[model samples]
Target: MDFSFLPKYWAYFNYGVMVTIMISVCVVFFGTIIGILVALAKRSNIKILEWLVSLYVWIFRGTPMVVQIMIAFTWMQFSGLPTISFGVLDIDLTRVVPGIIIISLNSGAYISEIVRAGIEAVPKGQMEAAYSLGIKPINTMRYVILPQAIKNILPALGNEFITIIKDSSLLQTIGVMELWNGAQSVATATYIPVEPLLFAAFYYLMVTSAMSGLLKLLEGRMSNGGKA
Candidate 1:
């Protein structure tokens, strides 16, 4: 129960925090794009495209993310399928790549629904008006529907980003050395579990709380602007 170990191990904790942030940023960046695409696919007029997107969302959402990461990493390593290759060179995808992919895919499943809900939240009148203006469906979505929908969904998207920040901890199970892994490493090395674990918890709390505050501020501004 040495309280003094916190300051001594702050550097390791900081490094871990940085890695966690990096992973979360990467996950959100790619995941948002994937989610938007999936959302659009789910709403496609083509039945096959809608069905495929539905299946993807159901499978990823139904499974545990840790299990998904394990499977992805193992498959990449053992499948002998080159993740990327040029004419003469091949690159093997490792734990980190699959780890990020799994997390991003999982995040996309949830974000897709958020996006779908956002799109649906727009009034039918908006769609009809766009159509009356001779706007193609794609342009209606691009210029009118999605912009309005995004405004409605910004708060939810922020919440999902915060969720991603926390869920990034699960990557530690695969030896990705994110925040939780760093805390675990410190605990194993120093034999003082509580302090390091608490430090990690504190870091998570700080991040999530800051995100919540920012989202709230953004939501308020949007609300005020809408009123204006």
Candidate 2:
């Protein structure tokens, strides 16, 4: 097989790789924030808030992400409403923005439970002691709870990051032109399917493997200090 095409198409592949990374990073950032809020809501004292969060998590986590993406894209098309708009400034949001939002919202559902489990894994005694010390609930959570919870959550969160990195490939269905899309484009253009696609697979493996290694190092460091 001629391997020379790689150098010739390096720029396209690189651009696609960057787009893939951007989508994964955006998903991780926004997904984590949304997950935290949902987890908090799930743990809320208010019954209605807890129910609402539970429903949100149930729907997203129960459904397939591809279906959600299809629904989102179709809704955007049918609504003919921009995913984001500044009415005063009259600026339109790009397709990538909505794509990121859709992916993050879907990912956030699963992350919520991960976060909730992490938060709950903290000892009850710590919270009781904080309360006995006259610490406000919010302050107690901010200072004592979340910091301890994070150690428990970090490994799972890292796994989620890796999952998002692979799942971002699904965005190609919406014309995102990410790594998978690049491989497909090259395959169609050159009439050679296997090589380019294999290359894309190799790239994905490289990225996720590196991430797993980093996460292992972090886990070791955190564990060295004792269990959270």
What TM-score does model 1 achieve against the real structure?
A: 0.90
Tens digits of per-residue lDDT for model 1 on 7-82? 7777777777777787788899999999999999988899999999899999999999989998988887664544
- In terms of TM-score, the best-performing candidate is 1
In model 2, how large is the Cα lDDT of residue 45?
92
Q: Estimate candidate 1's RMSD in Å.
A: 4.8
Go through the candidates in order and give each one's C-alpha lDDT: 0.86, 0.84
What's the TM-score of each model vs. the native? Answer: 0.90, 0.89
Q: After superposition, how far is residue 118 of candidate 2 from its true place, in Å?
A: 0.9
| Candidate 2, superposed: residue stretches over 4 Å from native | 77-93, 225-228
Per model, how many backbone clashes are there? 0, 0
Which pairs clash in the backbone of model 2?
Answer: none
